[model samples]
Target chain A: MPYVNVKVAGNLTEDQKRKIVEGITELLQDVAGKPPESTYVVIDEVNRENWGKGGKLLSDKEK
Target chain B: MPYVNVKVAGNLTEDQKRKIVEGITELLQDVAGKPPESTYVVIDEVNRENWGKGGKLLSDKEK
Candidate 1:
């Protein structure tokens, strides 16, 4: 079983999450010969305050 | 930067999640030479109904 976890920088809509779960499942099945039913995809939405890049929190970065 | 996403079969307590995050951060630093400050650990708690194993959903398995 392949469990794929995706970390996104911000929140996503339900539709977006659904598409991700579906797309990743299909990709794993196509590339790795895994079954869609056995594949698991979880998306973790991270707030900018908790995410850092280049030693700086994303929240503090210039927009 | 190393981003680690942990997928668990069930929910975890905040303390357990914290330990996991800290342990994984240290492991990445030790093995990959990644900085703890740049390491991000996101734990995804999957419901039994969503997690499938052996072609069967965990929720349907016999307890």
Candidate 2:
């Protein structure tokens, strides 16, 4: 089983996560031919300041 | 750049995806600590019928 984990900025409803997870599971099944039970997906959120790109945090870069 | 893609069952808002992306970026930065620009994440959605587990589609198993 393949466990797909997504890490991102915090703040989302369970419904939103569910939809995203379900969508991904389906895609993997078709492309990778992995069964739903054979695959697991998890999302992880974090602080914007902790994320940096090109020496600047994501939140700062977006500003 | 390392592009993280998540394939799941369809249906999620842009905002929700954004949040998920941001959260994941932060985690990689902390754990793997990769620069935000050095990494990219994408979410792909699909139909439940396409996802199967234990010889049953996700939708069918859920029912």
Candidate 3:
């Protein structure tokens, strides 16, 4: 079984989160050969200030 | 620098979760050369019935 984790910006709507989790679970179950029961998915959201990319904070860089 | 994902069972104490996240972050940073801001972690919990391994549910297999 495979465990799946997702990291995204903190502003996702509940619907988005739900769809993403379910999608990932299915993907892992089929692609990774993980059992449905053995698959776990976690989502972590971070503030723009806390996330950085390309040498700048995501919030700052995006603006 | 890196997006770190941890796949773990449910029912971890907050302390265990924190330690695991921090440890994974450090490992990714050191091993993958990812910046601190680029690291993210998520935890997911599932019922044993939903998780299977070795042709059996983890909860059932363990029991």
DockQ winner: 3
| Candidate 2 per-residue C-alpha lDDT over A15-56 given as tens digits, one digit per residue, 9 for 90 to 100 | 666765676566555555568876687766677777665788
Give the whole-model CA lDDT for all candidates, comma-separated.
0.76, 0.64, 0.60
Candidate 2 local lDDT, B12-37, one digit each (tens): 66766676567656555554446888
lDDT of 1 by residue, B1-63 (tens): 887667889887655665676677777778988988887765567899999999999999956
Question: Chain A of candidate 2: what's the TM-score?
Answer: 0.78
Give the winner by lDDT: 1 or 2.
1
Clash statistics: count for each candidate: 0, 19, 6
* Top-TM-score candidate index: 1
In candidate 1, position B4 carries an lDDT of 65
**Residue B48, candidate 1: alpha-carbon lDDT:** 92
What digit string (tens of lDDT, one per residue) describes model 3 on residues A1-63? 557665654455676667655655554444334567755667676677897676788788767
**Which is the winner by DockQ between candidate 1 and candidate 3?**
3
Model 2, TM vs. native: 0.49
- Judged by whole-model lDDT over C-alpha atoms, candidate 1 comes out at 0.76
Superior by lDDT: candidate 1 or candidate 3: 1
Q: In DockQ, how does model 1 score against the reference complex?
A: 0.11
